[model samples]
Target chain A: MSTDALTLDRLARMQTAVVLGYDPKFPAARRERFEDLGLLPDTTVQRLHTAPLGDPIAFSIRETVLCLRREDARRIFVKSVLP
Target chain B: MSAASLIAEEEKLATVALVGSPNCGKTTLFNAMTGMNQKVGNYPGVTVEEKDGLLVRGGRKARILDLPGLYGFSAMSPDEAIAREIIEGKSAFERRPDAVLFILDGSALHRSLGLLATVLQEGLPTAVALTMVDEITARGGRLDTLKLSRALGVPVFGVVGHKGTGVAEVLDAAVDAQSWPRPVVAAPLESAVARAAWSDTVLQECYREPKKENRLSRRIDEFVLHPVMGPVIFLLVMGFLFQAIFTWAGPLMDLMSGACSGFGAWIESWAPAGLPRDLVVHGVVEGVGGVLVFLPQIMILFFLINLLEAVGYMARAAFLADRLMGFVGLQGRSFVALLSCHACAVPGIMATRSIPSESDRLKTMLVAPFMVCSARLPVYTLLIAAFVPERAFWGPLGIQGLILFGLYLFGAVTAFTASWVLSKTLVKGSLLPFYMELPPYRWPTFRNVFLSMWHRAKIFVSRAGRVILPASMLLWVLLAFPRAQADPGVPAAVAQSRQLQQSFAGRIGRFVEPVFAPAGFDWRINIGVIASLAAREVVISTLAQIYGVESEDETGLVDMLKKARDPETGRPLMDFPTAMALIAFFVFALQCISTLAIMRRETETWKWPAFAFGYMGVMAWIAAVAAYQILSRLSV
Candidate 1:
């Protein structure tokens, strides 16, 4: 709800952000999968690569890189980390 | 934690399951632990591959299972569900493992450990095998396994699977799992946030983060996944793969066929000409030869595919093609299987295993046979050369080339359209989330690549061969039985023709002629169509034999077919319309029995294969009839 709130998909490439949490809009099962995949609140995420056609993008979080469809990424909220 | 429990567990081959997410080096550890002592089975209902192998030490042995990779126990796909079911003892195919070897990718701790937390709560005896330690350390990360082990109250072994380091220790520790320490307090079961907090607390002292993402991978992706260059590169890679299978494998395949025929000739040269000799040459040798010829192409295809998968290029290829393939209600992996189908549908069907979703896999497998495969080329070539004139069309391209291109295009269009229809009607499912892990690229290990190729070859020979060879024998019997009496002073070739004309297959072909009359085929073409079930190219030879020409004399047979008259009307047998009809039917029809046999092997049920045959049969009939009727009417 803050002015600085950003959905992960909207975050620019290579921009580092701290996970604020997922939007409550995601169903319970998908939300749990998000957490189980290490996207917990306060986790650091940096947008890495976008697929050629630009739908699925890869992000580096917790020393691992995961590819997320742009649709799924639009649901996760994050905040920019101060340099 | 008693010695008696350990002794009793050893009496039976205690089972240990390797559990981890995809791209976590779990298979590498499985190969390292079990060496060549591995067998692939399927989970009870789902056809996902279950890799079973053995771990031996001193005097004891135990079965080690490589369950399909899992991100969590949420069961997103059939593969994930099978992994969950087997681990929970809910699977009827496999008992609950006596112990679990949890492979934790050291480089992907946040991801692997998060999953690990949920797995530990399964209440099974567990040991952690830390993999990707080298990847971590190379990237300026460090982990103290001893400290992490103490925190979790479980034994942890650091393993570099490709190098065979610490793999034995994990198994040794897993075998005595009864004595392994249990956690004092389990991971939080209430919520995902609570579990993440639990993992963070445990990793606070032991785990360190890699300084940054892999630079080499990023540099490669710059070109490989570029908006413009990415598609260009993918096309080049696929085009090159297509050419290699058709061109490079051609000679080797010829050599295999040549050897079978040469051996058959050598046996006939010495032995008395009799039924036994003919059966040995045609029934056994030729039947086995058909199956064996696929080995080189299979080996090459798997070798390249394994290399791509091992080097992590396949995931990127899938990422690149996802949107385009999605238009057909399938994902990018289906494209790979369909591409491979151009060479042959046997390996193409087998490659569908790479597809993650069950419905997608079945859809890909069913429609792949429609792709213009190499076997159909012979029929197309003979027909087009005879019927389609060689007049120039667009630029230097001849009309013949254009028609051939049209046939290939038609095949591809039908394959995609069929899959779209299937996605709506038969194997219906929304396009699932395209979840793929683009692992950091590494050199593909030769041992792993060779082992994978070997496993596929074995499966083809054992599973497909069991059905195809016996079926080939039956086809030969139908074409060879109830021999016509040899008339004195008659040429052997003509006498052979008489025998074939009245043989069981010939009778059936005539019986079915009325059914095919609408499609412009008579009994001779019907016989060729039926004989094609052995392999599509057999149609050429069957026609050659029907005209009493040597089966090897293709040109002679072509001339005969072009001039011959229909028995009743004395009209030319094959015309432009019939050629159109034949090509139309071959494009849509599933003619090869071997394809069905392999489909049976992959799906593990007769239902889907039967449905594929029946539906394709109807499609072929309608297309053939329509093409013939329209062309004949327009010319009139």
Candidate 2:
């Protein structure tokens, strides 16, 4: 499975994952914060929105935005949120 | 009428807090808004203090909160934790600030905006206080404040905080918005996940492409931050500042000394003979003047340093020296406190709070006493004048100032080595990563510069009165008492001192003499050093008293220091070997009483302070012995 193929949907259910990498192709203003947000390896994040510019993929963890780039989204591992 | 009444009833008092990194002109804005109508009080539950001021805008008073300078609201430091707990409204401290005024340094908005974005997401009635807007434009960069203001969906005010420009309008907008309920956080997320929408929207709206590079800043940084050139610049700058201490103070010091001694002599004649005359002329005037002579040098050194700090170059200097400091097992931030030691060490120890780590602060506090403070200026100046020839040793270098600078350098190096050894043995921790934002340079305002210098000079003089005065008087009493019968055929004056030399203090000096002999310190120097435990300036006065000279004798300090005779060998006491040894000893000795007081305050346990003093005492002895032996062998 291509890392880019792992969508936020794929990420939300992951029991454990690290932000192994990131892609700047997305037009995120705070790429560094997104990278250095100190997210634990293999945490769950539920995707909420995809902005009009096809970047700034917003998600929720403890009700905080765990925004990530498309490539960053791929690096994270997850189990499906679906039962 | 119904809309107005409903809106009025719904409004609640709220807070707009300003938080940013230090030196970002936040205080200036706070001052302009609050003036003297501010209060500094600790947070209700935490020891960390908070400053709150009331600002009137749109005919309503809004509480302006100035939190501690936090680099980010997240992270584990107490400062950060406090900010986090407050924002979350989970802490025992007052509820979450009603709103936050995210002040960003316009010149460095990229990083500043990162913090701004975090604050904006709190779902509070927020605004952006864009500071240093003029500096950005002046430096060939332009900002569309309106663009930023619109994008963030909140009021954004372009303010030059220091000059009070555009701040009034900013306050008016803020105060007006305070009563209005927070606008629906319109920037969209999935309706189900609206909670995270605010964070994403704020980050997107408030920031733009940073100017590719700060060209002039980069050029200067290259040389100033170069490892090789950096330390050289630091040394040269410190050398210049220390040199100015003596060279600049010469005329003023002379004027002060002359006025004091002349007044002393004049008073002696006018006063009727009795206890009154002795107490007034000898105890009060002479002792006070002795301490006052060093004030000029202390003020001058402090003035230069305060200016450097205000102009923001000191932080850069610290950044440059971080590597070298790490080599010696200290963080670069400790350099600010150590640099302050040149003026006095008490406040320097207090300044170590910026170090953030307990062990690092402790290490800084332990070594700070070794930094030759202004109290030692009199002793160094008197000795150098006595021993070193006035002729320039290195063409342009003033021999006296060079020696003074050397003494300061010896303390600094020894402090570094001491901290390094402690780290290896007791303070076992790997060096933490040091991160500091370099504040953009600014021309320091004259009022601020002078006020800071005045503050430091006031501290030095007050310490003299509270500590030095009684300490000198006690020694004076010890030497003056126990009048022995005059030896037959000897003048009563000469015989009195001879008899007094066997007094308790004198005997104690003799008893301690053998311990100091390896360092070539004579009995008088031994007494001077012991008396100096109260404060170093007393060493000069104590020596004067021992030499049977009045404290106001301007010439005796120089002459006696030169003429001091070694008891065993009957040679000049402060010759090359002894001079070097004395300098080295003062360099390593933690002799200042205030240092002891501060150490006790900083470390609740007296045991650690006792250990600190014991460690420095042993180090001082070893250093003095080594210096004396090395110089003596060279002479032979």
Candidate 3:
């Protein structure tokens, strides 16, 4: 409910964001995978592009571009950082 | 099952593993390390395959295993699970690897290095084969391999896996498993948070990424991933892929078919002319050769698909198809598989290995056969040529062409529908997160491509020779026996017909005729259906035989088919409804034995194949009856 509680899915294309931790309601197993993938707090992720059909957004996280579905991406909260 | 023969008895060769995240060039490294000296087999109790190769240096041999790609230590998929258990020495299925040669992709260092935390935690003697360092340098990135080695407490050697650069040093160090040093400090296992922090610390010390991300992939993606242009390009690429399979593989397939038949005839010339010769020539050789002819198309398909995969286009293709495939309850990769089925389902089914999810792969496997393959071409051509009128519907599209296109469309729609129904009924909801790594574009090395093509062709040929040959022989027996009791003076064609009508296969055909009666199939058509199991084209020859026409004389056969009548009804043997029904059935039926054989091998079980056969048989019957009824009613 805080003003800074923006999720990864809302981040603009090519805009970098600082990880603000995963949503508490996110399933534990999947959330754990996000952590393993270097989504730790303060890690910077940049939204690169959306797939042709507008999902599985490609994001540069920890120097690798991962194509993630919007459903999972939306569950990870982040604060958009200006270029 | 292993490279055991390369070592002496009672002397166990040291084992080394090439481990990395997917698309990190681990397989490239495997080939670089052990070229033309590898074996591939399924890991016990899993459909995932195991590949290990022999490495010998100065009289010392080490077996190198190429573990499946993984992202992190916490196993998310079956591939990761298999790799995880083997590394931790917990696998009852495989001996613990003596050392781990971590394949580090310099271009994706942060995550790739972070994955190293898990590998380091294993505490197995470790060395890193730093790959794609040139990619980093080309992009103006700097990497000090010596500093990286010192930071990680393991030897690090930069290597271009495709070019076989620096492979000798890595293999030299890895070959002596006991001498390789373990990590100075085992990584924290409590959480990825701790590991990520530690890995970042290591990166901070020695890694400098290209300030600018690789721009080539970005520039290409701008057009390839454009909403309109991207899809158009995807279609053009897919259209080209299918066209290659259908048109290009034709001459090669014809050549193979010619060789098989010529060899069969040559052998027949040497052997005595009798029932045995007939069985050997017509039953075993022709039956087996029919399936062998598919090798050209299958191998060509395998090569192109692997090329797309290795060059990273397949990931882009997968991304483009995600939403569409998701609509049909499949991963984006399933689109390629289903499309490949349009050429042949065997390779289509084989291509499902790229689908990360197990159930999605199985569902895709189940759905693949419904797509019209080249095998069905002969039957469709025969039916259309024999019954369907040849009037032009439009430019470049005749009634015959429209009918063929309609059959293709029907197959495609049915494939998607079958997948949807399966999603709801059998596989249920796909709960796995639909995530994939859209890797940066890279040119495929000819070494990797050729090895891939050769490996697949070998597997297909050997497996086909083993499984399909015997099954075809059984079908031959059904069409070849019971001694028709015709005098030797009779004509060959009449003798052949009588012989076929009394053969066990014919008896079964007659027995099964009533079951298909409602679908407008007679005993002769039933015989064609039963014989088509060898391959869909076999129906043409089978039908040609029973109709008392020469096997190769298709024109004569079509004429006879059109003029022939049912003795009971005094009507044409194949009316419009009957032809329509047969075409409908062929579109839906799982008639090819090779498809089922590969399904059995890929799934590692007969249960799924049996299920496929049962469901497709039922659907084919229903579709046939519906087609027959609709057309007959309209005509009347």
How are the candidates ranked when ordered by DockQ, highest leading? Answer: 3, 1, 2
Judging by DockQ, tell me the better candidate of 1 and 2.
Answer: 1
By TM-score: ranked, best first: 3, 1, 2
Report interface Cα RMSD per prediction.
Answer: 2.0, 15.4, 1.7
Which ranges in model 3 have alpha carbons more than 4 Å from their true place?
A2-4, B5-10, B186-189, B391-398, B429-431, B551-553, B567-571
Two-chain DockQ for each candidate model = 0.58, 0.03, 0.64
Worst 10 residues of 1 chain B by lDDT: B1-10
Q: What fraction of the true interface does each of the listed models get right, in terms of native contacts kept?
A: 0.61, 0.00, 0.57
Chain A accuracy as TM-score for every candidate: 0.91, 0.50, 0.90
What is the TM-score of each candidate's chain B when compared with the real chain B? 0.96, 0.70, 0.96
**TM-score, prediction 2:** 0.66
Please give, for residues B319-404, the per-residue lDDT of candidate 1 as tens digits: 88887787787888888889988999988899998988889889999999999999998899888888888899979999989888
The lowest-lDDT stretch of 10 consecutive residues in candidate 2 chain B is B188-197
Error of 2 at B68 (Å): 2.3
lDDT of 3 by residue, B1-636 (tens): 565434522477788888998888888888876789887767765888888888777777788889999888663678788889899999877778889999888877777877888788788899898889888888888888888888989889999877778878877776687688978675465677777678778878787777777789889988898878888999999999999998999899889989989989898889998878888788778877966887888889988999999888999898888888888888789999999888889888988988889889999999899888888987898889988888888887899989888888988888888888889888986445667777888988878888888887777777656778888888888888777896889889878888889999999999998899999999998998999998888787787788777648778777877887765678777888998899889888899889888888888888999999999999899999999989989963
